[model samples]
Target: MATDHDIPSPCPSLRDRKKAATRAAILDHAERLFEERGYDQVTGAEIADAANISVKTLFVYFRSKEDLAFADTWLIDAVVDTLSRRPSGTSHAQAVGEVLNQALRTLNPDSGGLDAFHRGFGESEALRSRLLRMWADYEDAIATVLAREASLPAPDPAIRLAATQLIGIIRSCTSDEVREYVSGFPGEETDALRGWIRQAVEQVDNGLTRFLDRTSQSPGI
Candidate 1:
């Protein structure tokens, strides 16, 4: 007899498929328009028209134009999920690296998706502000995970600093400056960037491990 766990899950319903397709179409049209012109120049209504959807429907899919442009909530959730369930022996940095590596592999560097984002970032204060808020959220999430794993009363300075440093490394690597510089390379050089980021993370991991060991052995932790 087949157990509950042995049975395959049901596929998505037609409504779910249509909703997902609509969302994807909105993103596709929005990105293309943003890239061709500038993010600031493209209106949400224009995006809706381009996607062959009503402006009202566009709002249903995405709350705002900024929301449409910076839609990576899945990545944030994935990071938290991975950190929460990582093996006992795996370092926090290692778990983060695993998620990042998978994301990088799936990314198409030549797609120019990030071009508009970076350009808008440089041109618009709103974008720069949004970017900072996004990074802060990532830092806070990391710090929370670190605190939870350590069973700390709260996120201490060391834990917060370590989380900041890890996110900083990621932010620096993905900065508009690095992207422009890497654009000159023969290929996308994703491997080179990935290797460099890994080394940085590993170094931080080693330092964090040593610090934790020392603090744990001290009279007052």
Candidate 2:
């Protein structure tokens, strides 16, 4: 009784296709629902009915509401991929600097999808804590890339501490507070945000240079 466009394929691959379709449906419903009702407020049962999927099916893609809470894992994977493809001889700090620049630039509130995500995040505390934890993962991922590039004997505590410091600059220096400045003065008159970013980058650069200098200094003590 359905039209040609309405009829789904009868093949076995159609089952797999339908599974993927259902998964996407669940994610769409979850994202919107979490944004609407607090991430903790929305239940899997509510999402299942909303997305027109069985609760079991929703579990197949996501373990918990927290899974849906921070659904932009793909963005972090993209960051890792970008570092993987960096030119051959890049330093750990420079590679992170470039990646941070790209990542920060991608986050302009004028940009719609992620901007809306920012709004959603700004409202959720549980989500905010998890998001804060993700910054460490982001830095560690970059540090691993740098370690492999540098052929370190043990890329542990040192690379991790260094990466954490670099990421700290980006995270702390350019914060949600920057958005206030951006909105208040959207014109060229306000250099506050840009100045903050420059200062953070320079501090990281200087710290990195100092660390390398200490490493290279003749040990005559």
Candidate 3:
């Protein structure tokens, strides 16, 4: 008789795999189309048609065209998940820096879809606004994870401030100005960008500690 520990995990069912494949097809085709044309020039129906799925089915996966356009924004979700799973003794800065370094390693400077996505933000005010809102949500998610790790209550002021500062460092590293400079460059430029990210993370780690110490030492009365 097999014990519970001996039991193997079940794989996804055929139907579920097909659903995943379809979703990927939609996103891949949508990105290609958005890159070829502009975000505003592409319509949900067009993307659906290109993906060989009906518009209704496309909506089933994504709530709006903008959602489909920004599908890869899950980088924020990945960051929170990574931070949540860091080793127990890892410092906050180390956890965040490791997660960011992993992301940097995966960056493909030659990816046309990435360039187009960045261009999409530049071309549309609405997209920029949506991206700002998404960043706020990302910061909140990071704060929640940090609070849990520190055993603090949700919305803990210190944890929130730390999360905001870390997110700001990440944003600065990948801002439009930086992207424009490095997007079309060779691997050497990408390496330089990675170096800058490492430096920024180090600065935040040291700067935050000093600031906290100063605040604690100041007279409250």
Candidate 4:
């Protein structure tokens, strides 16, 4: 991809500038095409055409139509990095909060070119189903990493269950908050939504604590 000469200010580094340009071009076209035909109806070949790149190059950037699932999606790496950057004494659940909040905030309702993307996603059952699958994938990855950090054995079923609950709570809470805001409810409604999220996080911690406590008291796993 060519440099983003349209921007008045120069990017800090040429490498970053080029990479951003390529990523932006691909997403711009992807979003447009996705909005045009509903996500499932759009093809990668169409995306490549819209982005003025080869299909191979487009595939190099994005693996699937499902990738257009999120606007400027950076969940996997960004969430991991966010968790890693938390200061000492930040609880694991709070670290999770920071990761999710940082990831979602970058795509606020006012973001340009995103309104259509949100409309497409919100109105399409196919897109919603695909998002659920992606969410499951994300939760599984998070659970695997959490298991490693907590020194649990591979394929830790407990970690997976906790991760599933966490993911479910997050999705439900966020959706409820969005519903409240759209309905022009008071800020307190959103506050309640957050309270529920905090409760969900606390429940995970409590469950983990109980598990460790039981293991300590027991003779074997």
Candidate 5:
């Protein structure tokens, strides 16, 4: 009684599954090697060797060795999705806070992903600079979403400022000091980090929310 379009496929196709499995395998092996040896000490050929794939094949999935270090590049897309699909009553600042909280849970200290990300900073200035650029990219992407959500005809200074303030909280959470504290104490320090997360959200909700409201009715703050 149902048309073919009415029933969604339960899972990805075989090729997609194989590709995902291969990508996961690469990340798993890369993280292990990066943990055992330092990031600078590792090579693309070595990562491919560990994953049982050729260097050429490794390059197919990841453009560079640094690209392999960042498996959570999806967080950018996740932010865009979260903001775009957020509940009708949610403010842009509230949606950004939700994504940040989710990110903390996703890349918790126990996962070793955060530690690797932090360690890469001390290992290479290039990597650290790239990480900062990635944060800037997040800001720009979020600003675009905020402007669109506000129904602005074009980029607005007020929207950009709000986006920057919102993203600063995310940057603070991932700062070296915070990463060390969370990764060092593990079970004990998570609550403190959560508390900071709440405070950061409150700051934006208190400060930027009002600024946005005012600017929405006018040209500038």
Candidate 6:
């Protein structure tokens, strides 16, 4: 006696599921090979062979070796989606903070693969540069979404600034703590990190408001 709305949608088709498995296999082999040998030492063809896919097929899944190296662009997309879905009354800073809190909850500090991924970053300058570029792209994507929410044009400076500030908190929370945890050192707990994220967001939100107010109240030039 369920309505159409109450029924679950169909799962992905078999062909689509197979494609996803193939893509995951390629990424898994690529990451393992990169971690075992440095990123510069690993070749895309070798990764394809390891994954049982042809080089051409590998290229169909990812644009370049660098794309396979990070292979976590979905993380950025998830954040942007979370922001886009925030409640109407929520501020951008609060939305970002909540999304990051959810992200921290998913971290597995004891995962050896996480440790290896962090090590891989330090072993290759190219990998580090690619990561930075990916983050910059993510900031822009988030800014575009925020602009839409505000009914402003894309690339609005204020929206972009807010996006960067919000993403900076996320980067600091993940990069610093993950590196420390992966380094076999004492690292902040998830709860503690969440507290810090909230504090940083509030500071940025209030500081910006205060600065704008002061500027507006000052004598005109």
CA lDDT, every model vs. true structure: 0.74, 0.63, 0.72, 0.61, 0.76, 0.71
Q: What is the per-residue lDDT of model 4 for residues 28-87, given as tens digits with 9 covering 90 to 100? A: 888777667776677888888888888998878777666766645465566556555667
TM-scores of all candidate predictions against the true structure: 0.74, 0.67, 0.79, 0.63, 0.79, 0.73
The parts of candidate 4 lying over 4 Å away from their true place are 1-23, 32-46, 54-63, 70-73, 84-88, 103-119, 123-125, 173-196, 202-208, 212-221
The list of candidate 6 runs beyond 4 A from truth reads 1-17, 36-38, 112-119, 174-192, 210-221
The total of clashing pairs for model 6 equals 0
Clashing residue pairs in candidate 5 are none
Q: Which candidate's lDDT is highest? A: 5
**Candidate 1 ranges beyond 4 A from true positions:** 1-21, 112-122, 180-184, 210-221
Q: Root-mean-square deviation of each candidate, in angstroms? A: 4.0, 8.6, 3.9, 7.9, 3.5, 4.9
Judging by TM-score, tell me the better candidate of 2 and 6.
6
List candidate 3 stretches off by more than 4 Å. 1-4, 87-90, 112-122, 180-187, 210-221
Worst 10 residues of 3 by lDDT: 112-121
What does candidate 6 score on TM?
0.73
TM-score of 4: 0.63
In model 5, which regions exceed 4 Å deviation? 1-16, 88-90, 103-122, 179-187
What local lDDT score does residue 206 receive in model 6, on the 0 to 100 scale?
A: 80
Tens-digit lDDT string for candidate 3 (53-164)? 9999999999988777677765677678778777766656676777666665666655432233354433676777777877788799888887776565775566677888
lDDT of 5 by residue, 70-94 (tens): 7667767877898899897787667
How do the residues 1-221 of candidate 1 rate in per-residue lDDT, one tens digit apiece?
A: 99999999999999999999999999888878877888888898899999999999999988878877777576668778988898988877787777777777676775432232344323666777777888899999988987887788678777788788767666766676667665665575676567656886787787777444524645442
